[model samples]
Target chain A: MQLISAACWSTYRIFVAYILSLAFGIFYGVSANVSPKREKFMIALLDVLQSVPILGFFPVAIAFFAAVFQGQRIGLELAAIFLIFTSQAWNIAFGVYETIKTLPREFGEVSKAFNFGPDFTVRRVYLPAMIPTIVFNSGVSMANGWYFLMASEIISLGNKQVKLPGLGSTMMSYLAQGNIWGVIASIGTIVLINALLQIFIFRPLVRWSELFQYNATGSAPEWPTVVDVLSGLGRALRIDTFLVSLVSLGNRAYGKVAKYVIYGIGTIVAAAVGYLLYWLFTPPYPWDILVQIPTALTVTAMRVIAAVVISVLLALPFVIRSVRNVQTAQNIYSLASILGSIPAVIFYPPIVALGGRSYMELLSILLLLTGSFWYALFNMSKGAMLLPGVLTEMSQVFNIKGWLYYKNVLIPAILPPLITGALTAWGGAWNASIVAEHVQFGDQVYSIPGIGSLLTEATSNTKALVLTVLCMTVLIVLVNMLFWRPWYSRSAEKYNITE
Target chain B: MALLDIKNLNLTFRENGKELTVLENINFSLNEGEFLCLVGPSGSGKSTILRIVSGILNQYTGEVLYKDQPNPQPNPNVSMVFQSFALIPWLTVQENIELVLEARGINPRQRVRTALKYIDMVGLDSFEDAYPRELSGGMKQRVGIARALAVEPEILLMDEPFSALDVLTAADLREQVVNLWQEKKLPLKSVLMVTHNMEEAVFLADRIIVLSARPAHIMGEVSVDLPRPRDSRDKAFEDILDKVYSMILSSRLGK
Candidate 1:
């Protein structure tokens, strides 16, 4: 009964959260693209949102929402759902935005020549163009949600604690009582759910979405898929005709109300922005929180830099191996996806069991590794696969292979994606620190000195929370501007084969 | 009045804040039923002229008049076939043909029938359900032509449509296009095509407009007097090709 209830609650939260993120992502992503003036500002805002750790704001969300709802279960549930939305929303929005930017110039000409209205363009062109990207990132975001869901489920600020009824809480309760079997069962159940989703949902989606794959050319698979069989049956039974009629009716209904609805949404958004600006300027100046920033930042920065360097080194060899063959790349990719679904924090209980005096730092590094290393590996391998046939042919003509191949061809080719992967990896590492820098196993809790844990501790006091957020945002912006910007531009100039 | 007119056309491009003039004082016009070809040295703004006339680009200091009216928006009576085919990959040949009709708010069943008719006309009867990715380059261009024709526009603009296809395929398609126009099955009253191939221009055009190099201007206009299905091997055809080639070659020099 408990297990069923936990599953139900978890499912409910994820369902609501996924819809919210997807809606917000599309709404804001399209809005940003349509209005050219806000494009840069909106893009930058989304970048900051993604980089800001969700768990860092847990205390603020809990405190505010709890007061708003008077400590009701609904308030906690809303908080959990919002946290999940933060995890899933950014990537989807970025994917949508990126797709809009990169659509072929010819697509624009076709739209103009055909004189397609906004509805036709959005439904047939933009939406279809967005499928593979949305699906791929949704997989990534779902994995992201799993990691943060655990932390959000069991929220603690000072002496106050609220534990939502879900697998995360169930696992925590089991861990508190030293039920190793319970942990195993919970993990097993997670693995089972992950596998089932891949089979029923993701695998089919990725395959089905290939209809919208941008100009890929390969012979049709020799074997038929379940979708093929089902579609064939639908055709045979005239079910497709019925479905099309139903859809067109829905499309007509949507078209009728879409304009008024859009205007309504626009007004609300403007008011919200105006209100947020007002709140932002009406600050009491929580100047004291700046004191903790320097110490916590230095430690966290060191950890992130170390983990990123090690992760890149570790993932590089895999990129070479994976790119050598398609089957091998697919296998490696699926493994990463499975591993990604299990948050790095889940490894803490076992790491805590293997006890030592200085194990916390090592454990933090290990946690950081899981959070980051796969991104580089996945990205570089995918990038390597995109190496043009002519470049490879030229390399082969010149007898480029082994370390020489890496030097002459592979490294330069994968440099852009490598940098991109490293950027996201660092972002994930920053988010992971909220749990990595502070670990709880059994009745005992271990804490380390870092910005992640500092923010975690600061959550109890509103003033500290406010200042911590401000200081951290400034630190992140400065690092991005000073460090990553030059590196990105240099690499882009050197390796932009597209031009 | 000419079916289409481009007057005092001048175009410039800004790349990284550097001004580059692409066309200057480009004057041209098309009579009804004329197969007009714009032939110039490579990178001489031939396609740029085509785009301006199509009203796809308006930044140039010029006027493009369609039926003697200044075309502010893209003229619905005109249609274009792009050099790259521009067929959306996810859409099938049938769907691509129907896309324009759908934009015009045609019924679904009528769209299917109309699209199939054009597909047959393009000799792509069996390939209607195939995606653009599934089609060969030559077949893709044929689809491009069919899509343009599907709109039933009065003016058709083709931008180096055959330049990406094989020579034999291009020649075959050129003949078929001429046949389509000669048979009066195509509703288009005028065709304006851009190409660098001298033989292609001489082979198909009623009048070839020769253009100079960068900041392209009208160097000359050569009228082809050859009979129907003008054989490329014939002395008259070779003379025309020679004349156009010399005009383009001299334009490339300090002429």
Candidate 2:
């Protein structure tokens, strides 16, 4: 009964966060793509924010919300939801932005030809076009939410720790008590929830989203027999029809109230920002923490680089095999996704126990690898799938083989996706760094010297925490602007394979 | 003996637990010094035949013989031009041609020389350094032709080479292809092309093999027997076009 309620609480948190993420993603993505001038700023801002690790927001969440609600449970609950929101939102938003940006000009022209009003265009054209991207990203986002579940639910403000009643907190408590059976049970519960979500939600939605794809090739992969049978059962029960009608009814109601809702949200956001800015300016800031940032960032950056390098090396063999065989690609892809959805934090107790204080640094790196490696693996596998049929045929017909094939064809084909994966992996490494560099179990606090540890240490002091997060964000934004942005655009332009 | 022979070719695709027969009993041969066009309606597995012959596809049950031997492997003596002009976007026109040469183990110096020679033949002379994205659709196809010709293959396989181009560009490139084939400036033995356009088939092929719609098989072969610089305005060309059109239409209607 305890496990069931804890699972339900975790599910509730993830569900609410996902809903918020979907709304924010669509609004932000559409607005970014709609205006040319705003696109540059919005995209740039998203890039910076995306690089900021989810844990970086913990301080702000604690200081602002805790103060607003006078340390009430509602405040902490909102903070946890906001933390999960941070993990899930950016990717979905980026997905939406990309889908809107790349939507065939014909769609816009058709809408204009009919003189579609803003509401009509969004309802009939843009939203439907975004469904596939949103659905796919939703799976990734949910996985991320699960990965960060423990950290979000259990917050440390100053000396007092606020623990929410969820699977994450339950597991943490189990680890603290050294209860092996309870830990195993928690892990089992998580896996069950993940599997249920995959079967009931993601699989069906993925099949449904095919209808919204701009040039849907109708070559969707076949689901397993069980999924087919379940979906068939759904159809027989008229569940799909009922859901469609419910969604349509909601859409109609939303359309009528959307203008007022937008205005209301705008005003609230403006007021919050104004108040936050005032609070920010009247501060006794941590000046010493600012000086330590560059050195700490360098240390953290080195670990991130190490993690990304190892991930690429590990992902390469799978990517090469995947490019050669579709079956291998699909199998590896599904297996990796399942493994990736398991939170890296769950292994911390066992890993920490095994490694002990002597091997803490190595263990930290290992944990970082678990968190970040899948981005590289997933993106490279997806890139392999997108290898243009004509290009592959070109290689085969020419008898291009071995090293030569990798150089001229395969490498160039996967470069853009590899870069994209590495960029995300880089961010994931930074996010994982917080939990990795510093770990807490029972009454023991394990520590390492890095930006992650620095941020974790500063959590007791809100001013110091805010300062560390700010400095870290600045460093991340700088790295993205200087290194990743140029690399991404260059490869995307040069290595693009089109049929 | 024919340079390339596809005997009793059949291809079946299994989709969603159902067997879809795309081609059946496709028997054809490419003779030396001949221009043959396999003309059919779209989705008639005409392109699949090109793919099989080129050794990009091999799941089919049949023998594609090169030099009267069962050639399961891609033959070095055979090269293909894609409808989409599948040039590597990153590689310059020169590099694109050289890539295949490099694959064939031609040394660096000879690779450049051969690439340039073909580039000149296709009139893409100074444009060798330009990327595919920089080239016009007609020019991109020229590079495609040049890349195929650079391999100095005895048999050139073109899959709807002009279909993706505008009508005017297609007409212009069609003339160039004919000139290249007729002039015999390269070490060319024969040409096999797959096209859905009946007029394109009549315009290009010395002999046109008409294929029926799906589960496609050779309907009939029409010998052009026409002279060089063949004009579409010519009554002979129209008559051949009309015959090929009726053959395709009659089969489609029959299905």
- Docking category of candidate 1: medium
Q: What are the per-residue Cα lDDT tens digits for candidate 2 across A1-499? A: 8999999999999999998888778878877865577689789989987987778777667767899988999999998899999989998889889888877653553233223345545654676678777866776688888888888888876678889999999998887788989989998888888777766666666665554554333234344565567569967986445433433443443464865885698799899978866766676766677667788888888888999999988999999888846556555655665667778787785678667888988888888898889888877886786576787888889999999998888988899889878888888988898878877666577888899889876766666776687778888788888898899889988986654
TM-score each candidate: 0.90, 0.61
**Regions of candidate 1 where Cα sits further than 4 Å from its true position:** A220-289, A324-327
Q: Which pairs of residues collide in model 1? A: none
Q: CA shift at A100, candidate 2, in angstroms?
A: 1.8
**Candidate 1 — number of clashing residue pairs?**
0
Per-residue alpha-carbon lDDT of model 1 for A154-197, expressed as tens digits? 87745877799987788777777778788778766666766776
Report how far residue A381 has shifted in candidate 1, in Å.
Answer: 3.1
Q: Cα lDDT for residue A373, model 1?
A: 79
lDDT of 2 at A462: 68
Which runs of model 2 end up more than 4 angstroms from their true locations?
Answer: A110-121, A204-288, A324-330, B1-255
Q: For residues B199-247, could you state the per-residue lDDT of candidate 2 as single tens digits?
A: 8888888899999988898898889988878898999899988888888
- What lDDT tens digits, residue by residue, belong to model 1 across residues B109-193? 9999999999999899999988887889999999999999988988889999999999899999999888887888777888899
